[model samples]
Target chain A: MIDLMQFTFMQRALVAASLTGAVCALIGVFVVFRGMSFIGAGISHASFGGVALGFVLNINPLYTAIGFCVLVAWLIGWVTEIGRLREDAAVGIFFASTMAMGVLLVSLIKGYQIDLFGYIFGNVLAISRNDLIAMAVLALLVFLVIFFFYKEFLLLTFDAEMAAVTGLPVKWLNFLMLTLMAFTIVLSIKAVGIVLVSALLVIPAASAVQLTAHFKKAIIYAVFIGVVSCWSGLFLSAFLNIASGATIVLTATAVFFICTFLSPQRRKMRRRIGTLVKTQNS
Target chain B: MTTPVIDLQNVSVAYQDKIVLQDITLSVSPGAFLGILGPNGSGKTTLLRTMLGLTDPFDGTVRVFGKEPKKLKRLREKIGYVPQQSHIDLTFPIQVKDVVLLGRAYKMGLGKRPHNQDREAVEEALELVHMTDFADEQFGRLSGGQRQRVLIARALALQPDLLMLDEPTAALDVGAAESFYEWLHNTHKNLGLTLVLVTHDVGVVSRYVTAIACLNKRLVAHGLPENVLTEEGLQAMYGCDAVFFHHGKVPHLVVSTRDPEKT
Candidate 1:
C-alpha cells in the first residue's frame, strides 16, 4: 500500500477519488436532504447517454456526457416548472427515455467492441490528465456554489415555499441546485460510474447522520469519511490490482456499517440522559 | 389613515382546469392582523401565495405596497412567512441557529456571508418567540412546537413589516397551539408588523386578528371579526353552519360544525 503511491497513475487515482468523493458527498448532503436521490440517479444514467452520443460523434465522451447531462438537467428543470407533472415523475420519465436512447445509440455504433464497461463501473486509475483537470475545475465550482448559496440552499432544501416567501428566488436557486447536481454527477461519472456515484453522494451522509444531529457536523463527518474511503480504496485497489471504483464503494459501505452499529439512536440517548439527570439530582 | 400594504385586485389562480382562487379583491393595512379562515381546499394557502407572488394570478393584479407582487423583491425583505410546514428534514443535521440564519439570505445575496447583524437578528427573533434557549439545539431534535417556534424565528430574522403564517399551530397540541397564537399576537404587537394567519380555529384567532378574510375558492367576506364571523359568513366560508357554545371551564368560545354542504 505504501509503495503504490510511488507510481504516477496511483497518485492520479488517489487525487481523482478524493476530489470526486468530496464533491459528490457534499452535493449528496443536499440531494439526500432534498430527497432528490432519484434525480441523481436520473442524471447519472443520462450521462451514459452522453457517453454513447460522444462515441457516435467521435468526440471525447466526457464533453458529450457533461453536455447531455446539463441539457437533461435543464430540461427536467423546465418541465417541472411547467407544473403539469410532479417533479419526480417528470424526472423519472426523462431518465428512462434518455437511458434507452443512449443504450440504442451505443448499440448502433460501428464495431462497438469496447463493451464500455468502464463508463458504467468506472476506471479511476485510468483517469487522464484532462479528466483530472476537469475534476479540479468541477471541485472548485462545487465548492464555490455550495459556499455562495449555502444559506439559500439550506432554506430551499428544507422549505422551498418559505424560501420563496423570504425572497431568495426559490425557483432559480432550485434550478441552479439541479444543474450543479448534474454537473457534479458528470464530473464524478468517470470515477464511480452512474450506478455507484449516488453511493458516494448518499451513503456517507446517511452514516454521518448516525453520529451527529447537526447539519454542519454531518457534512464534516461525510467529507471525512469520503476522503478516508477514497484514499484507502485507491491504495487497496492498486495493491490488489482490482477495480478502484468497486473497492472505494466497498470501503464506504464498510464505514457506513461500522458507524451504524456504533452510533446510538438519538431518542434512546436522550432518554438515558434524562435518567442520568434525575439520578444526579436525587 | 395608513395606506394598505397588500392589495389584491381581481386576482385568480387555477391548477390545470380547476380554479383554486377566483377573482378576489381585498386590501390589508399595515399593522393589521388579518386571519384567513377556510375549510380544506378553500384556497386559503393560494391566497397567501398570490399575495407573496409565489403563485401567479390568471387575471388581475396583486400588489404589495402599490407595486406588483412580482416587483416586490425588496418588499420580501420586509415580509416574513412561516409556512404550514418548514419542509426541513428531521434527520438532516442542522442547528437552530443555522436554520434561523437562513432568513437573511435575501439581504445577504450571493457572494457575501452572514455577519453579526444577521446573527443578532436571529437571536432577537428567537428571543421574541421564547425559543432563545434552543438556539444551539439541533432542529431535528426539537418537538413539534419547538420546531414551529424555530421556523417563526427564521422568518422573524427578516425583520419583516408583514408577517404571514400558514397554519402555524396545525400540528400542535391544544395548549401549545393557544400559546403559539399568544406569542404570535404578542410579537405582532411588539414589532408593529402586519400579521396574516391562516387558521381553522376561527373563534380563537378572531380576537387576535384585527380583521378576518373568509375564503372558499374566493373571498367570501373580509371585515372586522364581528362582521366576518356572522352565521352567513361562516356558512359560506365553511359550507356548513357552526354551533357556538361557551363553557365556564374554558374562557374561549368553542365552535362545533359538521360538513358544510351536507347541511
Candidate 2:
C-alpha cells in the first residue's frame, strides 16, 4: 500500500476519495440539520438521468449530470416553496422517475458498456486526471460558498423563519443550498457512484452529530470522519481487492455505530431510566 | 402620541389556501404592551407572521416602520420576532449562545463572523433572560421552559424597538411563564419598547398587557385591556361559550371553550 502511493492512479484515487468525502460531508451537515436527507437521495438518483442522457447524446456526463441535478433540486425547492406538496413527496416522485429514465436510457445504448457500469457502482481506482481536476474545482467552489455563507446557512438551518425575520434572504439562501447540494452530489458521483452518493453525503454527518452536542464541532467531526473513512477505506479496499465505495460507506457506518454507543444522550437516558425503575420498585 | 411602529390596515392573510386573518387593522404605539388573544386556530400566529412578513397577506397592507415588512430589510432589523415554540425544529443541534449570536448576523452584515460587540450582546441578552448558565447547553437538550427563555434571549439580542412573540409561553411551566411575563412587563416599562404578545392565556392578557386585541379570523376588539377584556368580547372571539369574570370583587379571569379549534 505504501509503495502503491508512487503510482498516479492510486494517488488520484486517494485525492478523489478525500475530496468527495469532505465536500459531501460539509453539505451533508446542512442537509441532515434541515432534514433534507430525502432531497440528497433524490438528487443523486436524479443525476443518473443526466448521466444517461450524456451517454445517449455522446456528451460529457458531468455537465449533463450537474444540469439535471440542479434542475431537479430547484424543482424540489420550488415544490417546497409553492407548498404544492411535501418536499419528500416531490423527492419520492422525482426519485423513481429519474431512475426509470436512466434505466430506459441505458437500455437504449448498444452492447456491454463498462463506463456506464462505473457511473452506476463507481471505480475510484480508475479515476482519471480530468476527473480529479473537475472534482477539485467543484469541491473548491462548494467550500468557498459554504465558507462565505456559513452564518446565513447556520441560521437558516437552525430556524429559517428567524433567518428571514432577521432579514437574511432566506429564499435565495435556500435555493443556493439546493444548488450547492446538487453540485456536491454531481462531483461525488464518480467516486461513490450515483447509487451510493447520498450515503457519502449522509453517513459522515450522521456519525458526527452523534459524537458532539455542538453544531460547529459536529461539522468539524463530520469532515474528519469523512476524510478519514475515505482514505482508510481506499487503502483497505485495495489491500482486500474490494469495492472502495462500499468499504468507505461501511467504515462510516461503523463510526456512526461507535458514536452512538458512546453517546452522552444515550448514557443520560439509561441513567434516567435506571433511576425511574428503582424509584418505582421502592 | 409617538408614531405607531407597526401599522396594518385592512390586512387579510391566508395560509395554505385557508383564510386565517381577514379585514384586520391594527396600530401599535411606542411602549405599548399589547396582547393578541384568541383560541386555537384563531389566526393569532398568522397575524404575527403577517406582521413579521413571514406570511404574505392576501389583501390590505402590513407596514412595519412605515414600509412593507417583506421588502424592507431594515424593518426586519428593527423588530424582534419570536415565532411559535413548535415552529422551531428541535432536531437542530445548536448551543444557546450560538442561537443568540445568530440574532446579530444581519446587524453584522453579510459574510461576517460574530465580533466582540456581538459576543457581548449575546451575553447581555442571555443574562437578561437569566439563561447565562445555559449558554453552552445544546438548545434541543434544554427543558421546554429553558428553551423558551433562550428563544426570548435570541429575540432580545436583536435590540429592536418592537418585539413580537407568538405563543411564547406555550411550552413554559406556570412559574416560568409568570416570571417571563413579569420580566417582559418590566422590560417594556424600562426600555419603552413596543411589544405584541400572542397567546390564548386570558389571565396573562388581563394581567401583563396594557392593551388587547381579541382575534377570530378578524379583529374582534382592540383597546385598553380593561375596555376589551369583557365577557362579550371573549365570546365574540372564542365561540359562544367563552368566559371572563371576577370572583367576589377579586380580580380573576377564566376562559371556557366548548369547542376549541385545532391549530
DockQ of each: 0.68, 0.73
Tens-digit per-residue lDDT, B1-263, candidate 2: 66788899999987667888999999988888889998889999888888888789989988888888867876676788877778677767888999999987899888987889899989999998899999988898889988888888888898889999888888888887888888889988887889999998887557878789999999999998778877777778776775556753212566565655642
lDDT (C-alpha) at residue A144 in model 2 = 98
Q: What is the TM-score of chain B alone in each candidate?
A: 0.92, 0.92
Tens digits of per-residue lDDT, candidate 1, A151-233, equal 78877887777677776777788878988998888888788877788788888877787888777777888888888888888
Residue B238 of model 2, lDDT score: 74
Fraction of true contacts reproduced, model 1? 0.77
Candidate number of the best TM-score: 2
What TM-score do all the candidates reach, one by one? 0.92, 0.94
Clashing pairs in 2: none
Per-residue alpha-carbon lDDT of candidate 2 for residues A122-224, written as tens digits (9 for 90 to 100): 7789888887888898899999999998999999998888888898988899999999999999988888888888998888998888778788888899999
